[model samples]
Target: MILPNSGLMIPWLQSKLDTARYVTAGDLGGEMVADSRKAAVLIPLVLHSSGSTVLFTERAAHLSTHAGQVSFPGGAYEVQDLDLVATALRETHEEVGISPARIKVMGCLAEYFTFSRFRVTPVVGVLQPGFELVPDSNEVADVFELPLDVVLDSRRFERKMVERNGQRGFTYFLEYDGRVVWGATAGMLLMLAKSLE
Candidate 1:
């Protein structure tokens, strides 16, 4: 396992990603829907003096879908975006005011299929210190950071039985402070953690 030191984490993560056999839809017990919409999310790792932390956003309460849920900064692929990477960067900037210039993208995780029928690609990146956030109030309710160590440690996750659409199964979640991270966001985090192992 990679140590949580800021100095060691970046390169160690890159190496792990380099050799990673990325997950696929089938591996997650689902297949991509024929009409699935493409989306991207930025998994931004911020370098703090204490250690590294991951940035996340709470969606605005008024949103029609996934309202008030913890999520990465991202959205559906735009016609103007050159690719999914650009889509992730563009959405991050629009949602949290983290300019694309401030993010140094390391790699991408597998495409995560949401029950909402969006195939979301997770783009991993690192941000150096000194970046300021100017979150747009319309789409973002709050912005927060969780320590990288807490996120990467597989043992930190909590699994509970949940019934969705009348089917009972396990759902994974992570809690920090008073906030909960679950759903597709938590699934992607688990994927990253497993990849590192």
Candidate 2:
């Protein structure tokens, strides 16, 4: 399968998501928890001379939940946030210091429910060049980039069996430069990867 190239990523992604079947909770071998809280995450993609890359944040180890996990920049929905998209942009700016103005939102992927009872909406956005990061020390421990091509390549991901809350199930995982992206984050990437096919 061919992946989106540098000059064609924006339109390519938009078209793919527009027609692709969304990966709901059940499709990932899970179900949404009752009374799950709403959350949103920004899947930030950047264009570079070599190619496109996706930005991910390492959650601060001090945080109470999902601490030290590699994840997209986001958080639970707030009352004042306009919508899921707004929630995503707001949390992304707060966590990684990327201004909302610099990102062009392409579209949203299907909601991915987490074991923590949080329903997450992954918003795909492309970043304009020359942006710098200033990750908040309280929420973000580090920031890193992964090639979009590498991520979209389905062969790079591994399916593994794991137990959560006394139940065993399968999950997807991808490792890059010593950082492992798994759980809902890897699921979202796999969803996007399938779209390209």
| Whole-model Cα lDDT of every candidate shown, in order | 0.86, 0.85
Please give each candidate's TM-score: 0.92, 0.93
Q: Candidate 1, overall lDDT?
A: 0.86
Clashes of each: 0, 0
In the range 1-197, model 2's lDDT, one tens digit per residue, is 66656788788878887898886752237587778899999999898767888999999999988899899999999999999999999999999899999999998988888777788888999996799798999999999999888887778889888766566678888987788998878888877777656
What are the root-mean-square deviations of the candidates from the true structure over C-alphas?
A: 2.1, 1.7
- Residue 195 deviation, candidate 1, in Å? 1.7
Candidate 2 deviant stretches above 4 angstroms: 26-28, 165-167
User: What's the true lDDT of residue 159 in model 2?
Assistant: 87
Determine which window of 10 residues in candidate 2 has minimal summed lDDT. 23-32
